[model samples]
Target: MKTAIVGAGAMGQLFGARLQLAGTDVVFLDTNQATIDVLNARGVTLQTESRTEHTPARAARASELDETFDLFIIFTKGFHTQAAVASIAHLIGAESCGLTLQNGLGNAERLQEYFGPSKTLLGVTDFPADLSAPGMVSSNSRGKVRLGALGNVPRLPNIAQLLDSADLHAAVEQDIRIPVWEKVAFNAALNTLSAVTGLTVGGIGADPHARGLVASVLEETLAVAGRLQIDVSRQRIEAALDNAFAHHTHHKTSMLMDREAGRPTEIDTIGGAVVRLGQDNGVSTPVLATLCELVRTAARPGDNR
Candidate 1:
């Protein structure tokens, strides 16, 4: 299949490289000129604990994609989702599948707004990767992604087959919204804390105060989920937290990487989403609200304080 991976950041490059290495024809669509140039010239390079491989795939700015794709994977930052969709809409044929493995909520809805709801496939991944440079990615671990049609799409089997063909384990889920929220809740607990504190997952769990902060965030998130009738529990949230700390003990979250790179963080998508829900439901989320404020303040261009 002729696949196009939009966003072409760390996660996009990582997955694109993997599919290309597996002999699938894939290209990366990104807005960053330098990164696109490097990718088109040198190909996508990735180093994982198990192996290192570089695939010579095409790369182009989002505007340069003139050919239709069988699969168009959306991996852009949440804030950039709308723009990416607008730019790539021409390349999305009716037969193409739009899969969003982005980090937080609202992305699926945004995608559905552009492509028909039937063409949208929402999914989540726990793959941990860091983009160390243009055309280079460090995939610290191999993780699986769960994908499902958002609203009765007919391409579930085809999408699953493609993933299986590429040796990726993607399961069909009828009720994926729950797990998406679960993952979002889990990320809300740790990602913002790690970003604000500049600490690793293990580092946060090791500190008494940091651990307490994460627990507080999780508690508020669970309360919000309860109001939304999602059947989320503190036990489930804590268990996921424990698993994250155990598997990616020393990893820094994407939020922290954004902070380090002087890029805008996904505070709006993760923590900020929680804050909005709290306000809508009249639920109190002082801890999450405060954290969101601090992160936004830091991400501001001129605030330079």
Candidate 2:
């Protein structure tokens, strides 16, 4: 399949490199000239725990592209979702589909505005990709993707097959919201806490108070999910948290990385979204709400408050 990876960040580079290596024609779409130039020149380098591989890559701004694609995978930060998806409207054909394996909520809806409901796919992934430099990504672990269509469509399996062919460990879920919400719960707890406290996964796990705070955030988020009838599995989320705390101790969350770099974090979509849902559903999420604000405050450039 001919695919366009929107947002040439870490996750975008990781998936694009894998798909390109798997014989799929891939192009990266981004606004960063440095990233686009580096990718076009050096291609993409993906480093896993086992080995490092470099794949030839192509990248361009939306105005520079004149070809349509079979699929457009969005990996932009949540705040940029609308503009990012809208920027690629010219590259979307009648049969083209848009998939958002992005974090948090409301991404599929944004894609639906352009691709229509039947062509929008919503999903979650646990894959960890860290950008060591432009055109270079490193992942220490393997992760799976769970996705499904937003509207009644039969193309879900085909897309999953495409990802599986690239060794991305993709699976089709009948109810994609379950995994999506469960992941939101996990991130609501770990990502927000890490961003605020500047703590690593293991650092939070090692502290009794921090661990207790994590538990509170998780409980609050799960409650909100339950109130919304998402049926997210608490056991699964907790198990995932335990695994991360144990094995990915030194790993910094994307939110934490953003905070440290003075880049905007996804607090609005991840933590703030959950908090709003809780309020709408009459579920209390004081802890998550407070952390959301704390992360926002911390993310402000040159503030350091």
Candidate 3:
């Protein structure tokens, strides 16, 4: 099956390279001229803990694709989701499945609006990726991805088969909402804390103040989740938090990286989501609310610059 990877940045290129190495016809789509030029000139460069490799594939602007795709894996940044998908919606056919593995919440709902709920697949990945340069992705950590339908979509089997064929370790879940919420809650807790505190994942875990802050934010988010009947348990979120800090401690979060690079942070999607949901659910999330403001304030005109 022919598959297209939307937003061929770090995580996208990592998946594209792996799938191509497993002998899949993977095409990469990105708007960055440098990224496209680099990939077109050489290939996708993947660097893991063990080794590095370059996978060859067709590179094009999303608008340049003339034929319909069987599947489209979207890995765009959270803020760019709508515009990114809009650029390539014409390439999606009736038989195509669109999987969004983006960070934060509301992404599946956004895709549903564009591609119809029946054609959407929700996915999440723990892979730590960074675009060290154009066409070069620093895949410093090996991670797993979970993918499934959100509302009884008809294309999961076909999507799963294609992913499995590409050795992507894909699975069809009975309920994906729980996992999605769980991931969002965890990101709400740690992502902003790392961004504001300027700490590594390990640093957040080790520092008593940071750990306390994470627990407070997560506890408040769980309260909101409970109000929504989402079952985001403190025990589960805490365990996942610990696992994330332990496993990815050396790595910097995307938020932290963004702050370092003087780019807009995803606080509006992650922690800001909790604050918005809490207000809507009538659940108070003081910690998360405060962090949201702090991160936004710090991301001002010349702070990170």
- How many collisions between residues are there in candidate 2? 0
Clashes by residue pair, model 1? none
TM-scores of all candidate predictions against the true structure: 0.91, 0.95, 0.92
Go through the candidates in order and give each one's C-alpha lDDT: 0.82, 0.90, 0.82
- Against the true structure, whose lDDT is highest? 2
Give the per-residue lDDT of model 2 (tens digit) for 52-117.
999989999998988899999999999899999878988899999999989998899999999888
RMSD value for candidate 1: 2.4
Q: Give the TM-score of candidate 2.
A: 0.95
Clashes of each: 0, 0, 1
Candidates 1 and 3 compared: the better one by TM-score is 3
Better of 2 and 3 by TM-score: 2
Model 2's alpha-carbon lDDT is 0.90
lDDT of 3: 0.82
Per-residue CA lDDT of model 1 for 82-135, tens digit only, reads 888889988888787788999888898888877778888988887777777878
